[model samples]
Target: MSKKQKRVLIRILISSVLFAAGEVLIITGSNPFNEASLFAFFLIPYLIVGGDVLLDAIKNIIRGQIFDENFLMALATIGAFAIGEYPEGVAVMLFYQIGELFQSYAVNASRKSIASLMDIRPDYANIEIDGVLKQVDPEEVSVGDIIIVKPGERIPLDGVVKEGTSSVDTSALTGESLPRDLSEGNEALSGCINLNGVLSIQVTKEFGESTVSKILDLVENASSKKAKAENFITKFARYYTPVVVIGAALLAIIPPLLIDGALFSEWIQRALIFLVVSCPCALVISIPLGFFGGIGGASKCGVLIKGSNYLEVLAKTGMVVFDKTGTLTKGNFKVTEIYPAKGATIHKDEILKLAATAESYSDHPISTSLKEAYGIKIDRKQLESVEEISGYGVKAIVDGKRVYVGNAKLMEQCSIDFERKTTPGTLVYVAIENSYAGCIVIADEIKEDSADAVVNLKNAGVKRTIMLTGDSKAVGKMVAEELGLDEVYAELLPADKVNQLEELIKQKRLYGNLAFVGDGINDAPVLAEADVGIAMGGLGSDAAIEAADIVIMDDRPSKIVTAIEISRKTLKIVKQNIILALGIKGIVLLLGAFGMATMWEAVFADVGVSVIAILNAMRALDVSRYQG
Candidate 1:
């Protein structure tokens, strides 16, 4: 318990002892004072437990902020004392204080659960000067600085490993417990704990731009964006409190004056009970707490939701559209097969050699794959004229022979007769000395979890699973068929992708949202255009991440399904809290107004309902059951 809560506990104990003593004296017929003196004696315990609440009500009244929970509580208890009900008044305040203590503890626990992610903030960076390591604040560390991280220390900046090798724990950032191994020349992100060996890292980004800083900024500002349900509760409390307060006052005064033989004390007691039951504390506290717990739980699963508003929208997702490369498939291209033309003098190795040599100077992904497949040094002395034809391929003279390396379009442009391959990959046709030589097939590999992601989405009740890609129709069809996507739009440019997404958006169900998933710089436009933009944080460009509403830290498509599940579960819990709080309060409120309930029932309506709803909200933070 916090110190403030400790003080409240101490006050509660003292007041309870005093209250019990007075009741024992009254029951034993040993009361030492008259009615006036007894009232003064009971005032001591009432003020002890509820002084702050009365003081707050007075302050808010003076500041023109009436009709809050404190005001309702103070007014109800004070009216009890006016009607000579000293013990009942004291009991109401004591139980209300206990409820307040429960709320304080619950809120603190929820903050700690979410703030666990803030533990990733590094305290200092270790810099070497004059052959000795010196600790400096992370903000003082600049780009291009070399920082040394010891075993069991958190990495302070984003950098590449200059020397040493070790496994680093990325659980704080990626929410995965597995430790990633790093060697020399490998990229090391900040906020990861160096587990086993000391690592010398060359910094690539400044402290402000590091991954840790970005994530911290995202988490700290998450609560500012509230969901529609939370907003409704805020407005509801604002208007509901004043209306109930006025109703309670009319109930106290008008009934006794108009009804013959209606005792004023009995009607007044009923009005006090009505005020206590209608405090609106349960609805005011639990709704926002539930949404916050949901966001924290998602962070624990490697998904960063920008706000609760997006969490609300994700629960109603009807269609999920994906960008093929870097989102569903690994963007790395590799040579999967090789085919030499029939009746050609060139062998498979020779065909690869000529293709790799002709495309040596180019830096395209297909060129890099060809060079890696060739696995030999290209002697540029064998080349004479090298020319790149846009929309085609590369034309060069290799070993005193004219070599043309490009697509089937390039072959037709040069009038070279080549056998077209029907394989599901990017086929690169090659021609030497104006004759067909061979074809090398390059393909991007699919991610392991992508198929599971599709299956889970369908199981989760997503109506449409679609893919939008800039790859050829054949390659796109192959990946879509393998993943069992409901729809596929292929061979599109960046603008064309947005157009296709817009068309898909029009086809979604009413009250349902569409989400676009992409990871490239060109994907920024389409990501922004979607109802919810999900970016693959790992290996994704800065533009895409900036435009996205949610980020998947480890680039697993399956986590998207996890996010949807978390969102729907959160929405369910919030609805339950709303119904639970309002349902119990409504029944007791009507009973209190009709004189059918007493002060104890009023306490249960306000305090008991709040505690139950708060405990239910805390369940949103337990996401372990949702993880694989």
Candidate 2:
């Protein structure tokens, strides 16, 4: 706990004990109304509960930080005491202190929510060297060094497994709540807990570049990025306290000299009631509490919002655009079909092996899939004189035989006539020793939940869902139709995506906010250009998190709908609290100024409204109970 919290807790305890003792004495046939006895019965508990506020007011008087709520509350209660209303004075302080303690308690609840997300961060890592497990800082471990991950332990780094296999639980990172199978040559990331096996992994990234550490950093700094609301109460206090103080001074001095029936003390008493009623505590206390609850709730559901600014914008998003590559697809290419064209000489395995070897030195998606499909050992040493043709494909010599691998254009240039086939994905033809071989069709598979995500967003009141991709129009249309998208803009470069966003923003309906969801490195510009940028499938990419406004931590496209629904609900609660606090305070302030209400009523106007507003703000944290 912070020092301020400890001090507040101690004061509450002291007040609780003193108040109990005072009640006991008053009930035990003691003479309690005497100055000495009444002082003990009322003043002791009041001082314990409200002494810090009084002290703070005095300090502010010395430091020229006067005219705040502290001074108003302190002086009003002192006026109550001067008028022989000891119990009323004591009640105000007690209620105010209870409100303060509840404020602290609410903040602690929100902090606990943030602390739960801190589970992904590891305190230390185990580095294996020469068959020995040595404890070391993650930063000191280099690439290719084998790290040991034990059962019930989070993976400390992103690495490829060199030994052993395990069912690793990655729910913390993905929120999918399923354990993924891992074995030799499979990749694993930090924040995944080992379920039941000992695995030796070759670290691929530096500790500074690990995914869990970045996520922790994001969650820690998310609040700082959120912009605050208008803070209407603090603004009211800024002007109200000084105005009331000045008006009371005028009433205390000028009115007594002019009016025949007016006593300066009576006007001063009225001024004290006015001050007590105008503390502006309700708005000041509830706005921050509402945001704390909202952020805490989002963190629990695996949606990390950087600040209140994004939270506000998320509520206004009208059109949500999705990038077709990684955001809407699996982002991994797989062989969907193997077609040996009519009169083709080589079979499926021969075609796959030739293409895999010819494209071995390339890093494109189709090349990687071809390498995986061969099901044979890839010895780069055997394929000598390998060369990559920029944006076209590759040319290499496998066992002294010239091999060519690329699109139909490259194959046509090499004089290899391979018949075209009906395929919705990227297809590559292969030529072995200048002889025409069969084709291997590789397609970027649609995400498992893409259709459901689109449907859910529509149900969540999103008017339009669009897909923007660089792929051919035919392929883009096919994917869009399957996912039930409203529109598809294909063959778009990075600049073209921005153009589409501008057009959508111009034609946007009621909310006037358009969102673009993407995960590619090139989509950073578009992410920044949109009104609300949703980065989907952003597990380990820093660029996606930095450029986007809302990050779907688990890369689920459906989270976009979840975030919007949560934002809509949270914003509704926040506004309700604001209206509720002001409505109650406005009526009570009028009654107190006319002398129809006591100091006790004024205390409720100040502290009672605050407590209710705070309770309402807690609704933002209960998204599961509220969000469908």
Candidate 3:
């Protein structure tokens, strides 16, 4: 399928053929115990398998890229050959190439996982022109353009159903399993296929801003943001290689004169063993591979980690901060309670409709949700002379009558005689002809999983979980208590939230890292300041995702805990590999120095340790074992 794949197959083929021939030669008694001939037979296929690897090492040495794995491997094997250990030389090279191939396949597998995630890209878009079906580029389409979609096709842009109905699968974006049912006038997202029904949609956004493009872009570039830990090994090898090479030279020459005429073969043989033992295979290959595995594994769970540096920070976060609106609570405002004044003829719906209609001409959160609940589109013609007062609300002349929709302060300014209802939420009062009609109590409620997320974070080992919100003290306290949070601050402006995060970070500085999770344009400042900036609901503004170090694709705050769990697990694997690699290397290096170990031991130190570390790195695949 690829050049690397084809070459690996070729190497295996050559190794298999030569191996069989070598066994026949031994059995036929042409050379029953001629280890050199047996070694020659073994080395022929081994060289065919790994000749390119050896050549590359020599090329790099000539090109001044002298301190690399290839040079170390080449020097070690050639030294063995010079010491008249031909079979050992070939065996060492053969196993070293096998280890290199293992790491190569690991890289390919990681790319495939990310590619599967990116495959969510929609293949085509539907365009409606002159009452006829035609295909068009999604970029050429604009808002309000009608697009026809057949059954089992993905919608290329965010749009409303101008015609037709179907079940659309959204698992690509949210990891959600259910297929959502769509009807006329309902909105559908990109990356979702129209299943079992012909559909037409009015385009809402351009192709670049569509969910599919954003997701694919995010995943494709995920590896770029998150660098592997191997960078440290490269730096370590730069210094470590030359120092060890000099040490081996000293071991070869210095001991000979000091011992009153050291034998040439014995000293050179010991130096060769020293060279094999000091290949630095364990530190060079496994440490960084551990971090790469961690990052790739977390990506499979939709956590966009920016780098290993952040993964390290996340592993040590003892205190975590959160923004209230859109982070802890749902950003949408809802009518919590409706209070009707004495002798009012209107029920709750009638009061809601009047309020919805008065503010229908304006585009605001309170107005939008009110209009949504009315189940009727706003008639702009009926709404006349609409004027919005900044920091207040909108007032307009409708149906030859003046209508008002605003807070208690707006009502007080207008001298409306309406009784205020003391409640645990914001109160939107309605007035007709400057006379109070009724009030609708509204609040941005806590998300259903918010409390569970706090609990899970605690179980995930966070020492303290905090909430900082712009809402009133009562509302903030209610949510914090419900979620069983450790701390909370209410009625904070954007700057106040940052200041609070600063103080908490200072207090928690002694313990470990402090993480802040937010999904608001205003939260960008604080998100950048935290040790680990995690943004919930990455579908939020780019200002939020770009400012934060980690982005959760799903709105669930529980994913924050999942990310922490993943980081901890990843770090644990890294530690395990380090210990295993170093421990094995240490034992063999001592034995190699004393001539108690053979070339096989050197193979284990170089190639065998690498294979074990790689197998350990693949443990990052089982995310379910780490996630709660």
Best by lDDT: 1
**Candidate 3 residue-wise lDDT at 141:** 80
Over 4 Å off in model 2, which ranges? 1-229, 232-262, 337-339, 342-350, 357-365, 374-403, 419-425, 432-438, 467-478, 488-509, 520-531, 536-540, 625-628
Task: For model 1, give the 10-residue run with minimal summed lDDT.
Answer: 220-229
Instruction: Give model 3's TM-score versus the native structure.
Output: 0.63
Tell me the tens digit of each residue's lDDT in model 2 across 559-594.
787788777877887788778876876687667655
> Each prediction's Cα lDDT score?
0.80, 0.72, 0.71
Shift in Å, residue 443, candidate 2 = 3.1
lDDT of 1 by residue, 1-628 (tens): 7788899999999999999999899889999989999999999999999999999989988999886667767776787787676886787787667656654554343222233433568999999989989999999988889999999999999999998877787644442233556878889989789986789999999988887776655433432332233454435656777787788888889988999998878877788778767766566556666777888899899988776667888999989999888899887778988899998878999989999999998765678899999999999899779987644688999999999998897899899888999998878998999999999998888999999999999999998889888676888899999999998988665556666877877776652689999886556667667888899989776656766778899999999999999999999998998889788988998898888888778768876787788799889999998777
Q: lDDT for model 1, please.
A: 0.80
State in Å the error of residue 363, model 3: 3.3
Provide C-alpha RMSD values for all models, in order. 11.6, 10.8, 11.0
> What shift in Å separates residue 616 of candidate 3 from its native position after superposition?
1.8
Clashes of 2: 5
Model 2 lDDT, full chain set: 0.72
Q: Which ranges in model 3 have alpha carbons more than 4 Å from their true place?
A: 1-250, 254-262, 341-346, 375-403, 419-425, 432-437, 469-478, 489-502, 626-628
**How many clashes (backbone N, Cα, C below 3 Å) per candidate?**
0, 5, 1
Collision pairs in model 2 = 222-306, 226-307, 226-308, 227-309, 537-555
lDDT of 2 at 372: 82
